[model samples]
Target: MAAILSKIKTEAEGTLRLLWKKIDPNDLKPGDHIYSHRRYGLYSHHGIYVGDGFVIHFIQTETKNNVLRLPKAEKFAHRPPCPKCLYDEYKDLGVVRTCLDCFCCHEEKLHSIRYFVYGAPRVGLLLKKSGTCTTLVSSRTANEVVEEAYELLRSQGFGEYNLCQNNCEHFATFCQTGKKLCTQMSFYHDLEEWVKRRIS
Candidate 1:
């Protein structure tokens, strides 16, 4: 999709500035909701609109070699706060721009969905068992899966585990080996018998 945030209005035109002295990184929230058509990707709601340029957001750099770019904002509420300096220049204007089209949100969704059952409790249960992090489900690589889960572990007061390069190798090998083993096992299993009967 396009990187453009949203439709800008003439009324919203003016010099706008943002300061993040008080805002914490954790303040960023997801805007995407369940069951909405456009709710798939754009997840987090926090964004920082530094004037004279584009709005800023953080892409979570993952341990598994992926980036979930989040929409970063200086002012985050139901409505964008009209700064005092911008009021004179843009008070009479219409909506200039909105914080949307978040790449991080989209990426986060991708990371979440790859392993988890879409919007299911089983997904969380499985991920928790497999030591995966919680993210918006969509499509993502296996490495991003475990790494995201590890982040969650840390946040939950679990002691930070040393990130080892071997973990990456182990992850790739385990996934590959597991798939191969399952494929091999399927040939001797009841699933194969069921498929053969359906075809016969």
Candidate 2:
């Protein structure tokens, strides 16, 4: 019995060490901005990386806009809906706190980037405002910023999913700097300009 217990403890410790090695503990801090580019490279999504192998982000449920309902006599009428179809019908989307593993593992390949915010040691007492104005700047510790963002996510959630306005990047920027802005929009605009120049 003693030998078996010792082996189990050793295995558990080794497993934990391997898990921690995958994500460097020093690399991730509360309120750090993490983003990943979509497979097509046209857009990216952002999230807040809190400690303990977790990230907070907004998710929008995709409605089945083109669900086909064939006639009763159709050959496929007797076929059952797949598990994904059922999930799409019942899944709820919005601001959610999920494990980092789930966030990274997707069918579409993604490249992730992390951005660190300054003034993570000083605690400032000021409410973050939305938009481009940076008049009321305040410093906050990383933990404090993470707490405030988590509270907002738990209490208020978000308004709606707007690609141009309210998006994942906007949410993450707001969490770190108290300003809502989409960095990808500028990239897209620049790409559009480059295309126009090529055509002209």
Candidate 3:
């Protein structure tokens, strides 16, 4: 039992290294921004890693936007509350710190969402499919990112989690870059405008 429990966590890494390398949950450094595709790759849940296999993230308890849905039956699960984080404690959307296992849920893979692509690397990444990474660069150092995450966890200063105005990606990006960004949502908004223009 002990040996199995101590086994290497390879299943935690991404299977595809096409653009940004899939991150191993165990190898995550403090302040690393990571995410996992949920709801069949429709959207991802983002967070900031604070080492020790823990992650700080935002969650909107009643969000119905993302196309991600939970079966009604699981709402009445017989399981106990999570130990590492009283995950059940955050009944409302706010900053919360949880172990990576809880953060990623049952997902086998994770991605480092915030990355700097430059010069030749940018060329290769641009050639890949979208949603794989972002071109935004962070001016903040790792320590700075970690500091902000902890601060928000304590203050819940991020306000209510909104699927658009503010969200998980926004929270993690704010920690890592000291600014909020949600490119995917931005992409959708742009696409919506384009459709309207064509229809008009």
Candidate 4:
């Protein structure tokens, strides 16, 4: 069991490095953190070192816009290969470097939506139709959420929206006041619940 876990870790790292090299060969590194240009506060940690300019990292398959449809489904199981994996199999196209960031989407406008939280990191944007909102669960200060929210809204084409954080008697209050952001676990759990609730 221990050996298997270790091997998995090693493989994960190698995969991450290869992915990174394909994206930003010059700036990729193991253990390096990255943020989405569209969503503030959402970040992925635990990059793998593939030496000689390569790194691999994990990214969520779904975001808030695309909530989890099947919660019990295993991650990375039975799913089609990602662009990195595909590129690895066929490197003759020279697609690795250019398609790293966008995964060869070729879409000029790439927007990352903040759809879920897994850990206690207050990173990434929580986007909605009205505007984009930032998580406030990581701060004790009541103003932090508001400040971040304002910044988030402004960044997401809501320049005229006023930022306000209201202390709350309930969950929505936290969002209203930006009082306390939930831990990533809490956010994830709640997000899943929300998905279930909405779908149900």
Candidate 5:
């Protein structure tokens, strides 16, 4: 998906922008839900933009080693015991903050999804792609969303990462909307079942 964030754009020529809008790196705002395709859209990773060129996200321990391979952010994480950032502390699967450069480096292109979309709920259905836009509205403010992510990272309250039950998308959506759900996982799960039924 070719999506980026500047602000919500609508259908109108000069109005707010909607789904799949390509935006400059400077456009991302705090608490914005962003994602990127992984393995040719087999799945997408999700995270919350927490301002100051940083993003908060949930990662599995095995993947953490891979993430560490990315070029370190300007002001975060030294090889061992970086005093400025919490690189050493997040040893297992849980929330951690990293610069946008490191987060976006996981994939070739980064896409963003929005919670509380402007148009009707049916729009989301039409999009058909999970980890994109959602019709549900978020009750929390952007700052509140950012705060929730920080709180979770600080407290390690999200629990172990589970592909079926709990995952990164769940962590991000929860912080943005206070709801823990992963449409991406559900989308694939249903597709798998449908394929099984089709053949057998």
Candidate 6:
């Protein structure tokens, strides 16, 4: 049993090492945009790393009404409600700061179905571009960007979470630049193009 447990631990560590290799710990700076897409290719989530192994991102939390409803619904149904069903019924919670470990631990916990990391272009491109294509623009120093993000997080203090106008990507970009933008918009736009191409 001891040998079996040791082998399992070794395999888990090895898997983590492989995952970490994809991301350079040295390159992670405060205010840096970290993004990942859902496994189904529908959407993405973004956050600003605030250094010291923490990330600040907008998260949706269940509303009081929904919380109140769950028990009654479950009692009536004679079984627990589906997690996805509960999530669909809940309201947005808002911005939150969490350790990177918790943030990336599991997608379902975050209410994301599944997620995989991907490289994001420089913050400048995201700020300056209003369309699918990217263009260079003036960039802030890393320190300045990080400070801005921290300040915003402090000032905002968990405001509403709006998927279209305000979201995790908006929060990250706002920290990097004073602009609010959604990266998922481009994904949707591209998807629209793909569908149009297929139909036409």
**For all candidates, what are the clash counts?**
27, 0, 0, 21, 6, 2
Over 35-143, each residue of candidate 5 has an lDDT whose tens digit, in order, gives 7667665677788888887878888845554556766533344345324444443363578887765565443354443332322355345554766555566778889
User: How would the candidate models be sorted by lDDT, starting from the highest?
Assistant: 5, 3, 2, 6, 4, 1
Candidates in order, TM-scores: namely 0.16, 0.58, 0.72, 0.22, 0.71, 0.56
lDDT of 6 at 153: 60
Best of the candidates, TM-score = 3
Cα lDDT of model 2 by residue, 22-69, tens digit: 344368877766665466445656788887777787666333232334
Pitting candidate 5 against candidate 6, the one with the higher TM-score is 5
Superposition-based RMSD of candidate 1 using all C-alpha atoms, in angstroms: 21.4
How does each model score on lDDT? 0.26, 0.56, 0.66, 0.31, 0.68, 0.54
Better of 2 and 5 by lDDT: 5
Which TM-score value belongs to model 3? 0.72
What is the per-residue lDDT of model 1 for residues 1-200, given as tens digits with 9 covering 90 to 100? Answer: 23332322211121011110122223332221111011432221222232222222222223221122335422322233334322221121211222232212232242221111122233233323121222224343544433433343244322222223212212222222221111112223655799899999
The lDDT of model 6 is 0.54
- Candidate 3 lDDT by residue in tens digits, 52-92: 88888988745333324556644544445578776663243
Stretches off by above 4 angstroms in model 5 are 1-17, 62-93, 107-120
Model 1 poorest 10 in a row by lDDT = 11-20
Ranking by TM-score: 3, 5, 2, 6, 4, 1
Worst 10 residues of 3 by lDDT: 7-16
40-146 per-residue lDDT for model 4 (tens digits): 33422122222343323222223322344566534523423345434332222210211233431212444331222212112223222112223333232324433
User: Which of the two, 2 or 3, has more TM-score?
Assistant: 3
lDDT of 1 at 2: 38
